[model samples]
Target chain A: MELLLVRHALALPPEGEGEEADHLRPLAPRGVRRFRKVVRGLRGLGVKLDLIVTSPKRRALETAEILADLLEGESWVSSHLAAPPSEALLAELPKEGRLAVVGHEPYLSELLVWLLLGDFLGQSALGSLEDRFPLKKGGVAWLEGEPRPGGMVLRAFFPPKVFRI
Target chain B: MRDARAWVEHLRAHLPVALSGKDPEGVHQVRVAGRRLRVYLDLLGWRVLRDDLRRLVQGAGRVRDLEVVLAGPWALPQGFRRFLEGELHLAREALSPLLASPWTAALLGALEVLPPLEEGQALRALGRLEAKAKRRWKALSLNPSPEALHAYRRALRRVRYAKEFLGLPSRREKILQEALGNLQDLEVLLGLLEAFLSQGADREVLALKEALLVEREKNMAEALERLGLA
Candidate 1:
């Protein structure tokens, strides 16, 4: 199975007072423009996605939509992606074909580290994994192998700037 | 707390739509934004802005309550419907000036610079809010009176909003809020019917009142069941 992890595009800072408002915040216009080019650049590189799963938050959904539109893949929203990644998140994903999961910060980087090194000691160290394996907004990381922790090999990683055509 | 200015801007963005009264959702959104602002301000100990935001929510709330009642499933009599429409109109009219007034403008301006609160401070405030909500929940009996239920509902709303600030899910809190909110709506309807009866009671209105009474009873039973009351 091939896995692609994506951080959502740049989103407007939340305008409303609560977390609910944060969920509703949309991607910035610049984010949409740049991410479109990024998606197209990935498509040009022959990246093929069969399915895309995303956090239900607006920015993640928007990012997945852009990918699905340009990449010609199906997209689905899952509440599971909005929180800290767990075994359930991995279990919920299919073990076949190329798939992309779009979500937010530290969680995405943390998930990457977890997949490469199961129960990694650095995972508990504050900012250690993130500093080493930063996933900037709209960045994509590709991994190939089993879906379980420590079972996948990092094939390639593309920061948003690298993908901008 | 860095988002306080954004929150104020959001409320400001909704004000014109609310004043236009073209969309019922405008008022509803304004009320929601106002309530959220008040909650955040309360956490920051911005009492003046919090109090002003309360007034804003209360103003929007008047229109929102009538809209909800009018949109209910019950087929109200033409006369009663017209009466409710008049009330809604007055509420909207009253809301316009309040939203447009210089004091409100000043309040919005003052709100733009709400001091940022540290994450630790916010979490501590949320803890206090949760404790208050827990106490209110504990005070309620399995079969609580209408007033007790109402108080508990308010407490739950505060906790729910506070949790939202920290990006926590509140599905159970939301469910309870919905159940209690329905009961409260029915209670308000019953009160309005009584007031209408005092003015003049026709057979149609009287019949409607009896039907509503039965519905309220049924809802009350369900709400109690939800609270695990016998």
Candidate 2:
């Protein structure tokens, strides 16, 4: 399986008076414009996704929608992506093809290390790993292997800038 | 100045107990405090620490949802029970550090010092909340998916809380929220059951899911009636 871990694009700060207002924070107009170019660049690099699983948060959902639009992939929202990294997230993977998972920071970074090392790193070590392999907003890391911890090899890492270029 | 300060104190008092994970009420209270404060911030138009509070609430919510599931009167399969326990543990593991971090204290400090809204601003806040609730209720009445219903419930809650803050009549909002809260609980349970089924289907889990779905439908009807949308 080929997996792409993509962080959500830039979003407006939360506004208004409810939890939905917080959850519904959409991508800023600039984020949409920039990510469109990033998606084009991914297409230019021959990236294709069979499915895109995204966090239910609006920003990440918007990011996945963009990928599905450009890459012709099916998109679904999963709360697991919005929460902590867990075996359940791994278990939820559809075992057969290329997929893109779009979600938030720190969680995505933690997940990246978990996948790379086959297990969660200690908090101290994980911080160092995050520093070493920071996934900026709208960045993506591509890996190839079975969808299990330590089973995949990092194939490429692209910041949105790389795609815009 | 609208219970924001009280909620800050509420959160502070509950922090240690919640971090201990000894009493579920601690986390529950913390979640409540965080939510109340968020609404106050929105109404007062205070921008500081809103995102921080949101992250805290979401983290606590993951733990609280599992706690509710585990405490419910259901005959969960042993495997499913184990899975819930594992999920709850992971959620707590994720939430504990955030609650313990200095940033949380900073968030609390900032919330404590938020300037009070003016007299007219209080009425404006109430007006904004009323508009939001009406809009959400209208949308849900049109298409009451489980997700839409859940979103509607949150809007109702905001109205209820805001009204209370402003010392206005809020009993109607509270009644509606109670009807919706039961439905939301079943929705969370059904979601977990479905996710467990994804791993591999067990006959018992399937049966439990069917039972829950039936209950959810009945509750949905009651909720719609309560909101006069039936």
Candidate 3:
């Protein structure tokens, strides 16, 4: 099964210093406007997902909504996507076709890295994040092959900079 | 040591050095520090904060690997040296935004709210990690294959980080880590030399490649001895 790790579009800062404040924060107007480009980029790629799951956070929900609408699919809220995902959680996923996960980072990046590299050894060794296929706001990473540890490979990774939206 | 705050602070303090990624140790420290933070954050169920730092980690990781190769005892050509320097410069430049991300503040707040870790829980976690490391070390000691040795190095590195997280001494793990790293460095250098040779390097470069392969054999032998395989 293929999975796409999609970071939510850029959102405004938390309204307060609390975690709840961060959780409740939604996408900014600019974020919504810019994410259209990401949509276009995905459209350009022309790959279809069988399902879409997203974090429960407001911004992630909104991104999921956008993706669901754009990709012509239904979206579900999975609490697991809000944090680091477990292999069991992933194994239980519908294995029919491709799936897209809309969430925040380091959860998304950590999950992707864990999927790519068996153990996290050297993430910050040295270099620009760009060449690294970093998932900024509205960024998307394409992955496939087995979901087991170090069994997956990255096919495509598009940052927000890659899209006009 | 009692809670996740220490790990968070460790990452917060070292992030800038990782961002400044020109220094090899600094880059290596930052990557290790960030993963340590991720480890705790994962335990606390707050991985959202890890994304921004992961970018810095990625950039620093690539450059540090290159730096390690360039730092080898063998002399490299001026052209390759310039290429490596440019690569390092670009890598350091990529991590600049991570320093500015306000989301980092959110991570600190998240750390504060995580339930204070109990001593027992910390010890248990460290024990599990140590056991895994020992198992991996045993395998490497038996096989001494490059792949097995590399896996052992990774396991030891994780144990070292986890040991530090548990506020335990990681001196032995650190020593093993250095020996394993030296062997890994040789592998990385030999990889580049092989790539150059594949591209049809000149006789001088070919000679350098041969010398590096000989050095690789020595590094591997030392690494095996350190791991008690010899």
Candidate 4:
């Protein structure tokens, strides 16, 4: 099974903003353009997603909804991907399916490290676009095998900078 | 001694007592008793009987948790109160299918069996319990690694429960209790150490780490002494 971990696109700051920013913030203009580019790149690469799962958080849900629209599949909202993925969260993953998890950072990074390595250690660079897989906002990492807390192979990593073309 | 009909009758008699009460502590006790009985049957080498018993016990645990929720603020632990309040909202949203599950019927059926425990039987139930205890102790001593500690604890608990079930004399109960307590202390310390390691070596986290490690060593020494292995 394949698991795709996508960090949600850029979000407006939590406070001092319009109602949309308060709850279910729509993607920023730049975020939309970057997401489109990344989606096109994945399509061009012939990537197929069987399931799309996202955090209940508005930004993540919006991102996953967009991706589900683009990828043509149903998207599920999961509390498991909302925060630092715990053992309980890991235990809930479907045993046999390709899944896409669109969620927030720190947790995403922690999860990526937990998946790529057996333990929650190691840092993936997230800032620069050309560098080895860093988990930046709007970044997506394609992994293969069961969507477990551990034992995931890093198949590909795409950052927003990569979609600048 | 191996009559399936007699065994089923015995099981049915005890089921009701396990299910009649609605109190949180009472429900917990009944569920535990059912689990112990289930484990006893499992150790008797009855897989099919054991599976049925396990399903019943698991259902009781679920119902017990729900009861605690329904009882409101007093039923849960202080630390878990806030969390349970939120969970109760979710529980309300998903109560129907949960109450209607096959497991629920099995639990109610098991509870209906309780009143029969007062009756006397000719079968050598105590002897069966003795045999189960011997087997469990042997299993407990087989693996000593930290990873196997949980299994060891379970085995020890089985032995204790079997003794209680048979009303047997227990010379080792006190030692077993002490050993289990120390083991729990050690496990807590191990958890602290793991968390500290994950947080890295910052001054505050490190001080807490040192304190935990010291406590762990002290507890380990105490446990070894209690077991006569120091």
State the lDDT at A150 in candidate 1: 84
CAPRI tier of model 3: incorrect
* lDDT tens readout by residue for model 2, B140-213: 88997788899888988988888777778899888878867878888899999988999998999999998998
Chain B, per-candidate TM-score:
0.90, 0.96, 0.77, 0.49
Candidate with more favorable, higher lDDT: 3 or 4 = 3
- The list of candidate 2 runs beyond 4 A from truth reads A1-165, B1-3
Local error of candidate 2 at residue A97 (angstroms): 32
Against the hidden true structure, what lDDT does model 4 obtain?
A: 0.56
Residues A1-165 of candidate 3: C-alpha lDDT, one tens digit per residue: 788889999888888897688776778999988887788778777867677766767788667656764554444445577667577557646755788888887777777777787554555632223236568899999998777767789998888787773
Q: What is candidate 2's CA lDDT for residue B61?
A: 95
lDDT of 3 at A8: 95
Winning model by TM-score: 2
The candidate scoring highest on lDDT is 2
lDDT of 4 by residue, A1-165 (tens): 777889988775665576433444556767877787777777777776666766656666556645664454444445566567778667656766677888777777777767766544333332222233458888888787766656788898887678767
What is the docking quality class of candidate 2? incorrect
Off by over 4 Å in 4: A17-23, A70-72, A120-133, B1-230
RMSD of 1: 20.8
* Per-model TM against the reference: 0.55, 0.59, 0.54, 0.39
lDDT accuracy of residue A53 in candidate 4:
65
lDDT (CA) per prediction: 0.78, 0.81, 0.69, 0.56
For residues A42-145, what per-residue lDDT tens digits would candidate 1 score against the true structure? 88888888877777676786687678754444554556677887897898788888999999888888888888876756546635766788888999999998
lDDT of 4 at B196: 38
